[model samples]
Structures are given as structure tokens and as C-alpha cells.
Target chain A: MAAIKGFGAYLPEQVLDNAALAAEFGVEPAWILQACGIETRRVAAPEETVVDMAEKAARACLERIGMEAGALGGIIVGTGTPHRQFPGVSASLQQRLGVVGIPAFDIHLASVGGFFALATAVELCERYGPILVVGAERMSQVMAREPRVKESAILFGDGAGACVVAPGEGPVTVLDIKMQSDGTFVDDLSMEFGSTLNMNGRTVILQANRKLRQSLTELLERNKLAATDVNLWLFHQANVNLLKQVGQALGIPEDRVFLNLPRYGNTSAASLFIAATEAQAEGRMNPGHAVMAAFGAGMGWGSALLRVQ
Target chain B: MDIRAAVRKAIQDMAQAPLPADDSASLFTGGVIDSFGLMDLMTNLEEILGVKVPDSELMPSRFETVDKIVAYFQARK
Candidate 1:
């Protein structure tokens, strides 16, 4: 079995609030707020590459555990917003972290990318040592080019979150994880390489609610656990209202849900880990079961259960 | 509770604001409910009205105003 040994995140210094976006888009500030439930989002500096953010987050995670880069058995990055099409962030991250001769790779699962990486790390941890998983995204670049998609541009931000997974007993234990995708809804949300992001917001919202509910329900049932047994519900920070709807449908109370989208907007793959770290830091995550659910582009969605010691 | 009152309460609860005095006021165009808010309003309606709005019926024209929402449910009854 594998457990989360350390967690950390990197959010850019720049902040883009709703008022600035509303002024740029020629809409009322309240419109942005009510539409996506986002007050502000972080924008990466021009100099901050995806690898830079991932490196920092990885260092922070390693620092938390007082471990060095050489201690990592492998590195896995989950992201859709890569700096370039070739040479994924993992190779550069490994070099920058000074941990050579270790296997490293990237998983492109859109917003649910982080959980995909975590699940991969858990499996690797069985035969390896500590594995570093980072979910980093530079989404603001896409938004900057396509300012016309006001709703999507305003909802995406740049950030990265990282965690060190090791095989041992710890506070956070990975019990089970499941992921599924339906290509039929591929056009619901998508962004081709070097192209602007496209989304059918209403249809995506409807599909996400249905898919996330099904995934979470099946996860709990397979584990023989009830929704109430979960003390914390962490889902992708796509939209606050979407999360609320899914939680309501599952009969999970609002108090049990953990959210940080208002501050960071939708950081795609990084959202889940970002919220998980912040929730644990704030003492909201007690030593019990926590359910994490995420859905995004590719019409993909995933859910995982963890027992927090 | 009455159907109209239930619809008003759902809107109020989702928007976290007082309902408009005029029932004909547009909930969508008037900015009383947004896309996300609209989704919440639909879920709340299903709970309060004891009816499931099929995906085929989830159209903007049908949910334009409080009056239309009430009318739609009334016709179903």
C-alpha cells in the first residue's frame, strides 16, 4: 500500500480578480462572480515555465518530508497545459531537481490528471521507494490568446500542486481509485494543441454532475462505505455550483465538502491536490475517510477513497 | 407549499437574494440566475416539485422567467 507522505503547492504571485476581467470583457463584475463562483485567479509570470512551477512544488513536498531529490524513486507529472508538445515536464523536472537516472513521465488526463498521477504513484510505490507526483498547469496562456471565451478565460488560472507518495503507514492511505472516460462527450470540453479552448458549458455541467455522481457512488459501494463515512469530499474545482449539485445529489452535506476554487479558480489537474493540501493544513481533514472526485476534458472523470490517519 | 411559492423559494435559495416582485421578470436575461445558478434552480425544483425534469426539457426558453417555470409545472399537473 501507499500513503501520502507530504504535500505542497505553488500559486503564482499575480492575482486576477473578477473586476479586472469584467472590465476587460465589458461585463459587470457580479456577472463573472455569479456565473463561475470565482472571485480571483492566479496568473503565472511570463518567466514561469510549467517545469519551473512543478520543480518548486516538488521541492516543497520533498522539504516537508526532509527528503532530498535523490530519495525519489520516480517522478510523474499530470498536466494538459505543457510548455511544449515534445519532452514532457517530467524529464525537465527530473533534471532540474538533480535526480538523474530515475524513470519519469507525464499523464494527460485534463483536470482529473492529478488523481491519475496519484493512482499511478500508488502502484509504483509497491516496488519502488518514494514517488513524486506533480500536477502543474499554465492555463492562463491559453486564456490570454482567447479572451473572447470570457467565461472560460475567467475560470482558468495557472498553478501547480505536488505530493510525495511512499509505501508505508501514514496519515493518508490510498484505499482505492477508479477512472473512466466517455469519448462521445469529447466536444463538450476540449483544446487542441496551439488552439483556443472550446467548451459547451451547460452540457459539460450536466454531464459532469452525472458522471461524477456515478463514479463516486460506485467507488463507495465497491469499498463497502457510505457517503457519511467520508469526513471530507474533495472534488475538482471546476465550478462551485457544479460541486454543490453533485454533493447534494449524493446526499453529502455542504459542510463535508472542501473547496478552494474562489482563490485559485480552475487550475485543471492541480485543483484536487491544491484543495487537499489546504484542507489538511486548515485542520478540516480529520483522521478518517476522504473522497476525492474530479472530471474534465476528454469527458473524463475519476474518484478515489483515502483513509486519513 | 404552493407551486409558485416553491419555485420562488428555490430561486431565492439558489441566488441568495430576494425574489423579484414581478413574476414575469426574466430570470436568465435579467441576471437573476446564471448558468450555474440555473442548474441549482433545476435541482431544487426537482426536489421541491417532486418531479424530474427530463434532459430534453432543460431548455432556456422554458426557464426564462418565474411565470414560465410555474406555468410549465402547472401544465404537467
Candidate 2:
């Protein structure tokens, strides 16, 4: 129902390269790189909170269209690692942007949260002309207390990404959006309050592969579009291996998928917008259709079809 | 070849190494394969074993060990 005008990104200044992570884990940097396909990740400075990063990205989003904060009808944030547990990131972000009373809220779907927020904004944009959607998180801080996981510890970094969704056609309009989740596997990938982040690597990896493939396959069928018809594949930056697995299963070529997880690791909810922004800047988003797939905690997953305007 | 032999060869190919002497040995704990390997096994089921692992039947635990994998396919048959 709405078009995404432009995208904005904000990555913390501190770069946590593989060397430092490997040193902490007592493994070779090369091993980490080979195993995870990550080189460096951004870690928010101790003083920088989720709102701080979200503000920068939000400002950039509005600035792209020369729009003022007052022009936005609402703000929707997708984040699991808010600065505080009491007030969500969206409220604080609204205050920082100097906007008040516009129905700001947060979605706690973990990795797929960003895609879910954007999908909701597409429908809400009609009532709220130009809504701001941001996916930001301080993942390093959230996972700090969790036990070191050889497969997951080095997979997260801190960053923020945002997009402006306007009521009518502008830049890229979403044609269709579909989301589904099953609570049966809730504990497979979850984080409890005052408890460490829990992840069953074997189950998570296998299920993620199946779920992502299904999401993309179903989206193409529902839209009456072929997998080859998608101009760009802006999937969640979960991992290089998982992406490759899905791509192969669907017979989608590696070049069609836009990947940036190597430089930023998995930024959780921020992954999609961050990768989508990079793809647009790189001139890959010409006037055509793009498919975005995301899967994460809650065993949640979704797919969206976008038409480049 | 019997179902067990065919499944064993598929597992060995996925592991890309020699199989343990015992059929019931712990493949996951022995570092023979990880989560990624489990996915690879499922995707190749049709090509290697002529088995189609339906989405509902795709459980990581069912394929964790060699004997468990054999039991799963055998039961389905």
C-alpha cells in the first residue's frame, strides 16, 4: 500500500574485528572468518544506546526526502535490545527526533522484526502519510552476559537502519507481504530476562534453512512471479552459509542476493534495512521487483515483494 | 543395497570422512557433523536415498545419529 522513499544507515564507530573476537575465544582469526564468513562488526560505544543510534538513522531517512520530523505520521521501531526494558526504543527515538504523539511502538521479533515493521508500515502509511520505520539494536550489549558461543558469539554487532514509507508510489512500493510463525519451537532460539541468550545451533540452523526457503518459495507462488523474475534478493543478514543454502535450494544464483553480513555480522533486526540500503546505493535496485526474506527467533519468518519506482 | 547401507554411504559422503566403527556411535558429539551438515543431509535425501523429507517430518534430532536416521526412514517406508 506504500512505497519506501529511501533508506538510512548508522553503524557505531568502534570496529570489533575478528582478531579481537578470536583472541577472546582463543581461536585463530582465520578460523573465525572461515567458519562465519565475518571480518569485522560494529560495536556501539559504551555510552551509545539504541535510541542514540536510531536517532542518527531516523534523521538520515527524513533528510533523504527533505522532510521534517513533524511531517511523519508515526514511528515504528523493530528492536530486541532496547536501552531499557521499561520504555521501548520507539518512544525514546520519537523524543530524540523531537516528535510527540504519533503512535510509536516496537516489535520484539528479533531478526525478522525489521521486515515485520516495514510490512506493517506499508498498510499504515495510508493513514500515516509518511511513517518512519527503524531497525536498530545494541546486540553486543545484550549478548555480553551470555555464555560465549563459538558459533554465535561473534555473529552479532551493533547498528541501526531506517526507511521512510509514504502512502503512495515514490521509490519502491511493496506489492505483497506474508508472515508466519509457530510457537511450538519457542525455546529453540530465545533470550530470557536476566538470563543468557539461548540458541540450539543445530536446530536453529536446520530450521532456519527450511523456513527461509519456504518463505521465498511461497511469496513467488502467491505473487504469480518466478524466482528468476526477482531483480534483487535482499534477505536478512543472518549468515552467509544459510543464505547460500536457501539460494541453492531455490536455484537462485548467488549474485542475485545482496549480502553485507561479512562487514557487519548479523545486526539482528537491523540486518534487512542495512543490506537493503547498501543494495540501493550500489545501483542494484533498478526499476523492477525485489524479494526480501527474513527468519529468526520465535522461529518467525516472512517474505515481501517490492516494485522499484 | 539395503536401506541401512545406502543411508550409511549418504552419511559418510555428507560427513566427508570415514564413519565410526559402531553404527550407534554419537555422530554429533564426535564432531562428525554440525547443524549445517544436518541441512545438507536433508537437502540431498532425494538424490542420494530416494527419500523426500517433508517439511513436517524434518526434525534435526531424527537425523542426529546414524541409527536414528535409519529408523526414521525405515519407519516412513
Candidate 3:
């Protein structure tokens, strides 16, 4: 439906590594390491807003492709930590980029927010030239390090990831996508307008294990491919073990799966694009097929299949 | 094996840690079973007790204690 013209991400300079968390949580570093293999995660400065991060990431993305903001047809930002509920991040980011007269909006699907935007952009680019899709979050500001909410607090970091979806480009083609949501476990994970992060860790993991695999399976099957058919696996950078489990379940080898949860932690909506951009820059993406998937609040999950030509 | 015994054994196997002496103690609060351990316990329960917990009732709290898990299974009986 569309091809990713360029991708970019911005990670804050502050480091929240295991040693720092060990002192904060009053637990040894090994205890935290037992949960996830994450060594360090990024934290946005206190003053940085979601739109500000989006602006930086968007500009980097546009710069990567040598395109200007005025050339973009529209903007869609996927984030849970919008500066304010009214205008949201996309409108503010659009203004920050000095563009006008185009539809710019925000979708809050948590981790899958960016994937949903990308899946939608693949189709929208056909109608509206090129679209800028960004997933940005300031998770550190929202979630405190209190013991009660500590389960998810340690797992989240802050950053923004952006990508430009062109109507038709080469080298990488958006082939097919599958999205799913189950509101039954809505209460399992939540963060209100003024509230911080809250979630039943077991429930999130259980659903993520099931949903991520199912979505990936359906997409691969519909395209007459198997897990081995994909050259690279881009996941939401949530947890290494969970990603490994899903990869194993889908018959994808461990090496094929790209994981950056150690360095960036879970950036919610921003994770997928962050991983994609990093992979593209690292030249880890081989010329074949890459399947990217994400799962987050709203109990939403989706898979996007892309072909590299 | 009784339902409690089977569930206890599954939890013990998956936990890889010493459990509370009291069987009704909260596993999640006590940090005995995490997401992976709980899922394994569920799969073990389905096989060990022949009671497939409906997806709707798979909340972590329901299986927080062995007694609650037993009651859930008996409720379906």
C-alpha cells in the first residue's frame, strides 16, 4: 500500500540503567535484571514535551529523505503522553514543523499506536501524497517510581520515532497488515488523563504472548509466507524474553528478531519506529521481508508486513 | 492428585523459589509468580485439573491464591 521513505528517532541523553534503578527500588541489580535483560533506558528531560520530541524526530526523518515539512501531506502522531488532551501532539508538531492546511491528528493506542498509524498511513499515502507518522512518549514524566506502580515503571523509558510513508517507493514496500484489540482486559493496564501507569503485569504478558503471535501468524499466512520467510523481526522493544517467546512460537529464529529493550526500555508507542529506524541505520535489515508488531494499552496489537526490494 | 496439590506443584515448579507456608497467601504480592510463571501455571491447570478457565476469568487475581484457583475450577464443575 505504501513504502517507508525514511525513518528517524530521538532518545534522551539521560540514562536510567540497572544500577540507578537498583538504588531507587532498593533491590540489587540482579533482581531487576531477572525481569528483563534491559541494561539502560532513556529518560526525557523534565522540560521536554511529547510534541518537542516529535518535532525533532520528524525533522530527522524528513532530513533523512531530503524532504521538507511543507512537502508532507499530513501528520499522524501515536502517543499516550500528549502535552494536553485538546490539540494533542500531532497538531502541535505540525505547527512546530511550520506546516499548515493538512490533516494532523493523534491516536492513543499505547504501544500499538505507531503501528496503527503506520498501517493507516500505508493506505492514506495513496490518497494524500506522503504522510509523516510519529510515535512519541514521555513515559518517565507520567509514571512515578513508587513501589506500588513499580512493576511497569521500571519497564518504560522515553523517546520519539518517526517515519515517512510515501505513496509508492522502492526498496521497501508495505505489503499487508493485521490489527486486533480485546477490551476485556482494559482494566488490566491503564493511565488516566491525570493518573500514572497502572497494570497487572501477568495479564499484559499473557495477552501479549497470545496476541502478538496470532497477529503475526495471520499476516504471514495471508501473504502465503511463514515465519522463516521474514528476514527481520521488529517488535515493540518491550521485553527481550517475551519477544523471544513470540519469535520462537512463530518459528522465527532469535537472530532474526531485533530487540532494543535493553538500551531504550519500552517507549510505548515510540518503540516500534525507534527499532525500525535503528535497524535501517544499522543496515541490519536485509533485502527481503520484515514483519513488525506491537502490543500495548487498549489491549491493542497489530502486525505490519513489509517487503524490501 | 487433588486440584490444590496439582496447582501447588505446578506453581512450585514454575516459581523456582520457596513459596509461603500458608497456601492461601497472595502469590503476586509475595513476588512468587510473575507473568510467565502464571501462564505456565494456567496451562498446567488446564492439563492437571481438566478445567479450562474461561478467558474472561483469567484475571491474575483469580489465581493469586491456590484456594481461589480451586474455587474457580469448582465453580465450573
**Highest-DockQ candidate:** 2
**Clashing pairs in model 1?**
A171-A309
**DockQ-superior candidate, 1 or 3:** 3
lDDT per prediction?
Answer: 0.85, 0.86, 0.84
Candidate 3, residues A1-309: lDDT per residue as tens digits? 679987899998889988988887788888787877778898888788888888889999999989989998989999988888788899889888888998899987788899888887887888888999999998888886343454566788999999999887666788887777889999888876677677777788888887776688889889999888888999998888888777766789888888888888899999998999999888988789998899988888998889887
Q: Is candidate 1 or candidate 3 better by lDDT?
A: 1
Q: Quality of candidate 1's docking, in CAPRI categories?
A: incorrect
Query: Whose TM-score is greatest here?
Result: 2
Model 3 accuracy (lDDT, Cα): 0.84
lDDT of 2 by residue, B1-77 (tens): 37788778777787845688788887788777777778887776656666788765666777877888888777766
DockQ for model 2? 0.59
Show where candidate 2 strays beyond 4 Å: B46-57
How close to the true structure is residue A57 of candidate 2, measured as C-alpha lDDT?
88
User: How would you class the docking of model 2?
Assistant: medium
Candidate 1: which stretches are off by over 4 Å? B1-77
Candidate 3 Cα outliers beyond 4 Å, as residue runs: A145-149, B1-33, B41-54, B65-77
What does each candidate score in C-alpha RMSD? 4.7, 1.9, 2.8
Clashing pairs in 3: none
Docking class of 3: acceptable
